[model samples]
Target: MGNRTAVIVACALVGLTVSTPAFADSPAPSTYGRASYLLDESTGKAMISKRADKRVPIASLTKIMTAYVVLGQAKLTDKVRITAKDVRYAERGGATTADLRPGDRLTVKELLYGLMLPSGADAAHALARTYGPGVDGFTAKMNATAKAMGLSNTSYVNADGLPARGGDGYSTARDQARLAAAALRNPTFRSVTSTKSRTVASTADHRAYSWTNTNRMLDAPGSLGVKTGYTRAAGFNLAFAADRKGRRLVGVILGETDSSRRFDTARSLLKWAAKHPVEGNG
Candidate 1:
């Protein structure tokens, strides 16, 4: 009887050993953002989620949708002439700009670089005005697209995500993760977001311009281009994606108080996700 009891105990110990997770000894990653979400891109499985449903301002990450909408309607080669109105719109908001000049005829592709790389409000205004035929019209399309995409926690008030009277645009980390995953599927978006910097040479119609990506995680291994944003109200934000041995992960961090720490938190989360096994959506 004693031998039988010992044998049963031994078997239980073996089972426990076999079931132990490889990452059991590692601490879970810490995040500085008020909210965050991470997902396995291939399976749409959630790996990490925090305050994922709490809506908050998203700042210039709004440009991700802006680019998505424009990519759907306009060809990359389509030309858009920058107007004084576009420049003024950005400047008046005290928002970031690409320093784009009025009367400069730039291709949709160039404007995208300006829009994304620097998080340029002017570029967003230009694209919205031309594509929507008016800012209000373009904003409507943004809301429609968000609804169609099933991003229930998201809403847009303007093209560049500047503060509006009623509210600045808002979204949850979970919704932003889903949006980032969808946007990364487009090759043009992947290319544009992954780029670290872009320089368009001076042409007869436009002046030479250069812009740099705001996403610092681009330098990390397997990092993919997504977007970054900040405002006094929004804090630091990032929608990030990365691939490790063909396994891709997409994530969003919102309301991080420190700009550089947002990237650090993202990298730590990615590393944690890679080490652990995928689980059900959060």
Candidate 2:
């Protein structure tokens, strides 16, 4: 119940923990990203923070919020009609798409897979235009959701985190972890994110739209659903989660150096957190 004991307990849960300093109260860990944060999902306790407050590009991890807003505003069974403008916008942006095309009618549930799994931008565009009035309106709703969440270091320039003609999206690691925590609370969001592979039947013509999760961290034990992200500016950003026994933890890393490093860093952090096993955090 001492403050010193509480700090030590919290750090262990974050993983990549710092040893108790011989002369100082706190010290930073070297084995982390340019910005990183880890949280105990069950309790909302911050387990780790390294430059977690600095804002930076978040890439496809922005989809977590995109999916969040979509699920809140639309029914999963509602069918949405894709437009030529939606397909063209996504393709022209060089975004990783789900191969969705104009005339493809898919349910909001299917589109959720398109957004979370494979990190599809076309899916994001379709959902935004259909559910959001338009992409701008959806993005505005995303910002409003961030505001309601009290996220000071978060903003959405686009639904899929792709660069617009003007700018790309950005958020801090801490803010991102907070976003992931809120998102994972949704059973639907959690279920979709954790799914490794799925085939959705298009409402257009019953064509199977198969997709896979982009989060390699799922290969790790106790892995839960979250999201992945990348851009030249954001590097290999990732928002990941894992559950061990009953303990759940969320990890957010931005500006990682490469693809392999992104998953490796997350795996190591979560594994360490699992082995360390913060008390009462379970």
- Candidate 2 per-residue lDDT, tens place, 123-203, comes to 999998876788889899999999999998898998989876687777998898888888888899989999999897765
Residue pairs with backbone overlap in model 2: 14-47
In order of appearance, the predictions have TM-scores of 0.89, 0.87
Over the stretch 1-282, how does candidate 1's per-residue lDDT look in tens digits?
455455444434432111112344453466656788888887667766667789999999899999999998999999998899999999999999998988888899999999999999999999999999899999999999999999999999999989998878899988989988989888899999999999996454545898999889998888886999999999999999998867889989999999989999889878877876664533
Model 2, C-alpha of 228: deviation from truth (Å): 1.1
> RMSD to the native, candidate 2?
4.9
Q: Model 2 — which ten-residue stretch has the worst lDDT?
A: 19-28
* Candidate 1: pairs in clash: none
TM-score of model 2 relative to the true fold?
Answer: 0.87
